[model samples]
Target: MDLDHTGVSADELRRLLRELSGDLLSRRRFVRTYVEMWPTRLSRLVAAIDDDDLDETKVVLLSIRSSSVMLGVTGLAHLATQGLHALERHDLIECRHVRDLLAESGDRACERLLELEATESMLGR
Candidate 1:
């Protein structure tokens, strides 16, 4: 999917928000909750990677990918998918490459999410 300069799929976000009845309050609540929990999820991911446990990594990535897709964090979802594919192929090197890319993409996605939250607050969304 084409993403905005923020490296996030704003269109997807807009679509989902519309589906949520355009409820800014709900959106804010959900976003806040996800943001609060993301660090723990990320820590689990790092631990999985450190252990070089492919199964654990795959499980974590799957969870992350699904959550990201639901929340329109396409860059992160895509990176996670790439990692999964690498793992499926048993390409540890490629998996590591995608892991770095996932880290960068996830950082960008989180920054964009914060920016979105700030924009919403500023606009009284």
Candidate 2:
């Protein structure tokens, strides 16, 4: 059999998200759930794009875009917006450009997420 993941299929991702989010609404909803995990998700997406896994990158990028807006993160939305265009239409080389745009931002996002998670723990939220 030729096993393949053409990209992070929304269905498979949705199943995983339900496990994490404790809800089962739709694939879009699953993606939106990552709004709270944007830092981790964006880092993974950028890495996936660098590895030339556009599909996986797309899923994470999609999550970031949707989640960013939903979570009131407009400044970070550009990263996902650029990633989406690259994933949907650009070739690997061009896609790398989009990934490059996000590289530093992803790093910052990770740091922010870490700090917030720690604060949340301290506050018992």
Candidate 3:
């Protein structure tokens, strides 16, 4: 899939995994782990935002952004980065916008990850 249309650099993800791990099984396992934790992370992010906790929000956003970069989840990373910038500027409204975008993108990414899991299973991976 050309995920670039959705602003995701799939090639970067593939390259990073190949460079860092060079093992398909390990990479797949990481993907599964990431998919499993994604929702909980999102919920925590929302809670931090709702509580107006800038410190917590920065921590969570940085974690998510760094992990997303490793996973080649560029859209999520971008959203988190935007949120961080908004937080730095004390723009709560922009932070909310970024949060919404992150949620929407994360949901779609989750669906795609599930599909990838199914395909991998079918391929005996």
Candidate 4:
């Protein structure tokens, strides 16, 4: 499968579908859940950062990075990884910058995933 310009990897999504025994319904459900939780995740990440809670910030960044990697959200994953590195260096400024980037990229990624899902369903993929 070709990679999407939306920063989502169609190949990885297909792999996930294959892991679910090619069950489209399951894939759709998972995607929906992921999309729905995105805002909450972002909110939690912001809260953690604003509170200067390093541990919480680390947990949130790791969660975002791991989940994004699995979901083929490469841009968001990269930003999350950057946030983690910034956190490790105790660079709040860099961490804040990455957090902003994540907010933008993550939203775009989720929107693209939804669009992809709709297109796939319409095309009977």
Best by lDDT: 4
* Tens-digit lDDT string for candidate 2 (3-119): 121112223333443555633344334344443465577578767876877678778777766755443344456656766776667666766765665555554543443444334
- Identify the runs in model 4 with alpha carbons over 4 angstroms from their true place: 1-6, 123-125
**Model 3: per-residue lDDT, tens digit, 1-125?**
52321244556546755675556667677777878888988888899989999998899899888978787677788788889999999998898887877777887776665565456445544
Show where candidate 2 strays beyond 4 Å: 1-36, 107-125
lDDT of candidates 1 onward, in order: 0.73, 0.54, 0.75, 0.82
For candidate 1, write residues 1-125 as lDDT tens digits. 84432256656666667777877777777667666766776777777877899889898889878878877777778878888998898887887777766655565677787677667556644
TM-score for each prediction? 0.79, 0.50, 0.81, 0.88
Off by over 4 Å in 3: 1-7, 114-125
Cα error of candidate 1 at position 39, Å: 2.3
- Model 4, span 22-114: residue lDDT tens: 788988897888889899888999999999999999999998888777777777887888899999999999988888777767777999988
lDDT of model 1 at residue 60? 84
TM-score of 2: 0.50
> Model 2 — which ten-residue stretch has the worst lDDT?
2-11
